[model samples]
Target chain A: MKLSRALGASVFAAILMTGGCDTVWHPSIPPVAGPAEFPTGQIARGAELAAIGDCSVCHTTEGSRPYASGRGVQTPFGVVYATNITPDPETGIGTWPESAFRRAMREGVDRDGRNLYPVFPYPHFTRATDRDIAALYAFLMTRPAVHADTPPNRLPFPLNQRFVLTGWDHLYLRPGAWQPDPAHDADWNRGAYLVEAVGHCGGCHTPRNVLGAETDGQALAGGEAENWYAPPLQAASPARQGWSVDSLTAYLRTGFDAGHGAAAGPMTAVTAELATVPAADVRAMAVYLTSMMPKPAPAPVVAHAGEDPVFAGACGGCHGPDAPMMRNGAPSLAMSTAVNAPTPRGTIQAILQGLPWREGQAAPYMPPFASVLTDAQIAELAAYLRSAYSDKPAWRDLPAEVARVRGAS
Target chain B: MIRLTVNGQQHEVDAEADTPLLYVLRDDLGLNGAKFGCGLGQCGACTVLVDGQPVFSCLTPVSVLAERQVRTIEGLGGNAVQRAFEDVQAAQCGYCIAGMVMRATALLEHNPHPHEDEIRAYMSGNLCRCGTHMRILEAVRQAAGQGVKP
Candidate 1:
């Protein structure tokens, strides 16, 4: 998800006047010899936590050494390249003491005290327990260090200034380890901690204000990520079937639940990483998330099979009622959360991008149509799908939206 | 009964709605052009033209084919694209050849003179497991050069 935060000049000036300069610089820690060894159990636990955090998804560039960190995340201000987090002495966090690592996670600052852009998602990381952070540090320090300099961020003059982020932290950063609610069971608390802290589902799923802070009380109420909409997990969820713990657990682990459609776009990577972690942890996350969701209200069946030749010719081979995929338990289009989503972007994106073929793995596959079909054809197909499968009103100005998504992709 | 228009002929075939077009073609009508390599549509062995668009007939139910023009390798008979395939000897096991020919025919019909990259991109949906991609690509290129007469 791109960070789209832009501060008004008045707010910037006020923050500067009200002590933006106070903690602008942090004392750099002296480089030290890497730790010789860490407990295997601690490192293993850290590995699991890192998978839940999805650190590699944003940090590592495609086809590069993991955690060397040259992936440039697009933001409204500019592109922010993820910093090298490997234990490389000069280029990475090799010299970072556990305290330094803890501070960075809790305060979103480097050992040298430069304010990190929130694109690193340290806001959510701030709530991680000390034990988890220590484990993560041990795990990271044990990895093969790679020397790679992080590219300079491409932000404009005022935004490029690192101290500006100090003000942002002041406005939004909530620092503390998660505390279990007395009322909830252990599963609920464990799920809550993981979801609210390291899992950080809100990083992409929660809507942000102009300042880029997650909106006050709309946690997980749908947000945008990497051009595709992250569907809400809250009451606003458009899922035709309510996501239960089992369904959510299955979806999180394997990227697909029979009742819901397959995960696509950024979520595909997240689910793949989640597959590596313990199944119980994923199940805990499901428990917490499903608690926030309402039971599936029985939606009145809406059947309008209006003929759209593009859909039939293009989509019918697998998605048609009589198609083998549908007959063999592929989720019906009516049950697809993307098709039932309020916006047409998700459905349009699914059509244009299609599910990529995973090599050797038996996953759902659809050929991309960005080149094959015109924007108008995709837009018409999306409209047909909405009417055919969903009870929601037809999306207005779909052709323009399709053009926008196509161009963005 | 499903009414389907295959090539220039209209035929009423008795089959369930969910029956794949490939099954109806091979089992009932006795047309053996489209082969079933992978019924999941990944291999694209059972490709046919539905209203000028190439689709996997193995995954396409006959129920969705009503009033749509269905063109198989049998329907092509001695078309230029098929002739180009024969001329270039693009078949190894020849199982994937029919589907490859149908996809190439659709591409040639649409573009007629596609560049090599364009041909590769368009034919990506169809797979040839016999390691005969170079020959299949050559066949499409050769057909484009000869200007496929649809």
Candidate 2:
């Protein structure tokens, strides 16, 4: 969810806007952190699991030898360097036994039994089954080992104390494999396992409580990731048009759906990686997700007296009647997902920076209007789209909202 | 197995209960007029008349249509709206026309001669990415003027 929002080079805007937060998770190279322990017996599945776990992303700093930890992860409290997970006898986890690696992953402790920082995402890793962890271990250990020293961390006083994560973990971590519901079909169960546990998609999607535990009852309801608002995944989301299994599957697999447009932000990276996961697995995720979508409410139509010349002069040149096609044809804004989205953020971001190429695919293009149109003008145009095409209520105080969003990102 | 009545013909077909009626119509029954533009309901491309009202067939599950009458462009027949659409050459690519025809038929069935404003608001849900809005409006007006019930 937030992945789509963090799309484009504009994520730097998120960093500029935040005042020290968990924004480290966004706009990073490498994929989500890759796994450490592997099921060496199932090396093939282990490699797949590592990609899904994003083990390589967090653990390996960009341009650095793979898994040679030294990549600085910026957290609200301080910076944490990822640990080396390669097979180097001296530097990496080469000498550690599977049991020690398992303890470190499941218990958030290191070889010498030191507490590891929560930034390692151990809370989510605890859900990985023993076998899968072993595969990941196998995958990591077999890598052409790189000899690089693990960088020292620079954390604020108490945050520097690694044991602080213990209390934090006690409050937030629930270590166990996600058990399945007997009632759901096999595909649904598969999807639940992948989404809630293996993929740990909810780690970034679900909102965290003060103790940093994902809040209950708000699952997939959206969160602020790396400064982007991952829109709610629940069926009741403001995405009034709704998501079908096919659309969701396509979006998850390819990152582009005519209704939703291209994936923006870090989601581009995810969908790129997701392309490698089994197609059946992605389809199952869609099946489970479409079941969760809510029916849309009856939205009244907005009657207008005359055509807003603003649209005619600008959007109309391409999107208006007789307008030439632009950007695989400017998606007819009338039925467009961005326009109909419950929150104005997607629409706002699209206008700020036109959709960019994703996964080697070039979509229709519209030059960014950030420098061209004033914030007030954008708000009016957006409001006009809601009233003109869709039956949803007009966005409130759209001018200030646009300025606030634009200024922040 | 699900039973459905399409174009006044009753038939039983094998499908998952939640499979979209559009798929049932196109893939099973071989009704090909409706196109799948956006499987989501936002776009009315896969629209068909369900009990005299235009419903997005892509989003309407076969289970929900078990007892309802379904009408695709193939079932809509050659009505005044279809005639006007042909007379004015309203369609360019024709991918979206099947849904457009279905929706216009429903609009005229509910109101034989709706005002231009009503036509614009009602048909807004039907997207014509080919820039055929003016011709579409003209066709609707021509249909309304003919005083033919859809």
Candidate with best lDDT: 1
Candidate 1: regions farther than 4 A off? A1-11, A297-300, B1-41, B44-126, B131-150
Docking class of 1: incorrect
- Lowest summed lDDT across 10 adjacent residues in model 1 chain A is found at A1-10
Count of clashing residue pairs in every prediction? 0, 29
Please report, in order, the local distance difference test score of every candidate based on alpha carbons: 0.83, 0.70
Q: How well is candidate 1 docked (DockQ)?
A: 0.09
Chain B TM-scores, listed for every candidate in order, come to: 0.96, 0.97
**Candidate 1 has which clashing residue pairs, if any?**
none
TM-score for each predicted model, relative to the true structure: 0.78, 0.57
Interface RMSD of 1: 6.2
Model 2 steric clash total: 29
User: Model 1 compared with the native: what TM-score?
Assistant: 0.78
Error of 1 at B108 (Å): 17
